[model samples]
Target: MPKESYNVIGVMSGTSLDGIDLAHVVFEVSDGNWTFDIEESQTISYSDAWLQKLKIAVNFHKDELEKLNSDYTILLGETIRGFIEKHGIGNLDAVCSHGHTILHQPHNGFTLQIGNLPKIAKIAGQKVICDFRVEDVALGGQGAPLVPIGDRILFSDYDYCLNLGGFSNVSFENHGLRLAFDISPVNTVLNFYANRLGFEYDDKGKLAESGKIDHELLSSLNNLAYYRQSFPKSLGFEFVKNTVLPLIESFDVSDIDKLRTFTEHIAVQIASALPKKSGKLLATGGGAYNRFLISRMQEQLPQIKIEIPEKKILEFKEALIFALLGVLKMRNETNVLASVTGAKRDHSSGKSYEN
Candidate 1:
């Protein structure tokens, strides 16, 4: 498709395992200026059973996972069709999906996102674009943090753009190149603790306020090996289930103290990722709802300004970015950042399917 002729739906399910976000967007390129319209958007929360299945997706055996992959694609197709009907979207150029990230162990040179292709086309009766990370990872990159390209193109005004979803990643252009990576796990770790107290998440960080910070735990978590790793890296659900949970368990502490300490750890790491200059830092995702986490970030470093946009923007920014990614892929433009993921070179990485 030509740059001037593109309209897409970008689907995204983050590592948070929160839900699927779908956006019907119209992208246009005129006189080399890229623009977009978010026509409609909605989130489809996972059912208890689906949540449980996806929670353990990182641990599924190969054959079982392969089956679930196709099944999940069918499930997504149904959801997307319902979204289209609900919003009265028509003449969609394509549905661009960032299939759920199941495993991201780039060191072992492997990553997986399981949403079958042909099954999706069969079910949706529409062209689809998915499986966006493997190509970059195969080319010696962290098959993750692929959002910076969107940030660079669509949200170029911000000095720093930070996403506080399942993981914390900041994007910014430096030295004539865009730099981004997984800074730390945000909602993934916080939501885990909050769930123990019969809450889905620490809404506005109220639970965290009731909890006391364990300085020792805070120090220990801040010193994790992953934090010391260089850029072009990412985190996985398995890493959290295997590495993070065990490390927290080793302390044998209460959930409150765990939340308190972890919030501080997040603050330290996030503050460190800020550029050594003064500018506005846009914060988004579910973590923005965690007031306690935001407070810790402010207390740790008052130099950087953490600006949260409108509610819809905070919730659907990733979904919106994915929509833009689809626009780029459709135009055969580079959506992956070489400076961020250390890919052999910048490139557009996705496989598109036609119905």
Candidate 2:
């Protein structure tokens, strides 16, 4: 028997503004299979100041954004250093991070993810892999829903893979090709409304469960032109701010009513993305804890059997997937999917930093 080598830190901050999730994992690749052992994981919540700053950064002047990018890189470096010290695990290989997505408007030909990689490498004293989306976007891809590559590689046993994080996105094989995209808004809008209600999120969906579903609202959401646009489409903060929020605000809807209706809408769009019942489906992301949302999705999607994996997968799946993408990039494997992201071709994405 021989000793195996494994150690890496994965960092992910999603669009829901939930804050940063850090996973200390053992990614052991051997015998043509991948084995992941998550030794430690923690989430650091964002301060009110950070959240507000991120919201405004979307509209920031170029110079201001550039400045903030440097600042953010320092911020991430500090966070990772603290995380490493607290965990007390050594023998590090690398740190893979999916930094905060600041601006994602691929149609307009730009996406900004600001966090200083050199700074992270400097502070963390580890080889770093960050900025995982730019190269694909350069090829005219949506530069999002990048986790499908991980899903296809790590959890390929499942027929479909859906993640309900700040946003709900899904990936499944169709005609021998893996396809994935953002289905619709999830915690991004839910947290927005929940913040209005003085909470970070609608816990267990109790608030939504207590209220009535507005059929009219559900109909409007279901009829949104984006739903009919076909696959490979993604939703973002701008979509929520510009389209979803405005439409929801125009109506004199109750808080619970809005929550209930929106949960249903999420369930609807998620159901639409699923393929016909074949094998089990793997569902992860923060939104999986919303018992009401999960129940609703289960009811609507009777054909697909949905299973939420262990807590580590449910909470840190995106971070873990981003880490896997980083690994693929290190190996120079095909990471981006042309069919899923509308890129000119499948390519390796992300930049590397050496300490």
Candidate 3:
């Protein structure tokens, strides 16, 4: 018989490098319907050493990355163990981790997410289900925007589910198929410029609001080739490093103007990508908290109703969905959707380790 409920911890480290988000979630299935409760949650910020290593780890040679992977697994295991002990969280069926992404160029037929070493289960003293994206890539898919499965199952009430994290992505049903893809870079770019001004983030986009938009910069950003690409695509730190940052830097605009112009670009692109029909849009992730960005999106997408959930859901939805992914893996059910990722077919993708 299938289990009706599962208690799991979902750990996520986004490309934005904001922190590692951990959520103790309970998933329950009643009458073929699913529901989840985030019992406990918190984000553990990375130390300067770890942050610097991860930021530049992409530039490391193959051998260097392998060594860093080993070290990162240890750090990830330790961090998860700390969270478990601090919360006194018991009855954990497994720990589901979306390890920090180092390289995500699926077009090249490979992707790497660190911290999924088998030793993690030993260190955390729990079964671990992780490395969820590798198999999809092997199947010739982009292996990204994996959270759409959760949107389809857990939060189906809304017509569209949009996440504004390091990058912006949206998931929605179209003609009975779930479709999703990355829209544009978000905190990854905004926070970079914010750091230049000595702030961690723009703090509700106050800096952007204080500045004027640079039309030339905005036009250049909107015309980028990625924006013209079709679905089954995703963006990564590499895209920002190779495409976004250099383009932004080439323009002679104040930091504030750059921020503002980029913010507008984000709004315009998101609005353009959204479905034309009116429907509810559930917006979450860190960027949802950016009042200025949301306002700009609203102006561009007046037809679509935007809904921001409670604080817990806003900040930890990705972690919560990773927990759902774990639960699906435990049940031997498909957790990744081929329609969304362009994989050969739907499949359950994760490596399971017994402690």
Instruction: Please provide TM-scores, in order, for all candidate models, with all chains considered together.
Output: 0.97, 0.95, 0.99
Superior candidate under TM-score, 2 versus 3: 3
Candidate 2 per-residue lDDT over residues 206-323, each given as its tens digit = 8888889889888988888888887678777888888898888887899889998999999988887675754688889889999999999888877767899999989999888878
lDDT of 1 by residue, 1-355 (tens): 3748677888899888889998887777787677777778888999999999988878789998888888888889999888988888889888888888787877778988877466786577778888888888899998778889888877788888899999999899888899998888888999999999889998888888888888888888788898888787788877788778898989978998888778888999988777664777888988888888889888866877889988767888888888787777877988888899988998898888888
For residue 145, model 1's alpha carbon misses the true position, in angstroms, by: 0.7
lDDT of 3 by residue, 254-334 (tens): 999999999999999999998674889999999999999999999998888999999999999999999999889999999
Q: lDDT of candidate 2?
A: 0.85
Give me the displacement of residue 125 in model 2, in angstroms.
Answer: 1.5
Candidate 3 is scored at a TM of: 0.99
The weakest ten consecutive residues by lDDT in model 3 span 271-280
Clashing pairs in 2: 73-116
| Superposed model 1: Cα runs more than 4 Å off | none
Better model by TM-score: candidate 1 vs candidate 2: 1
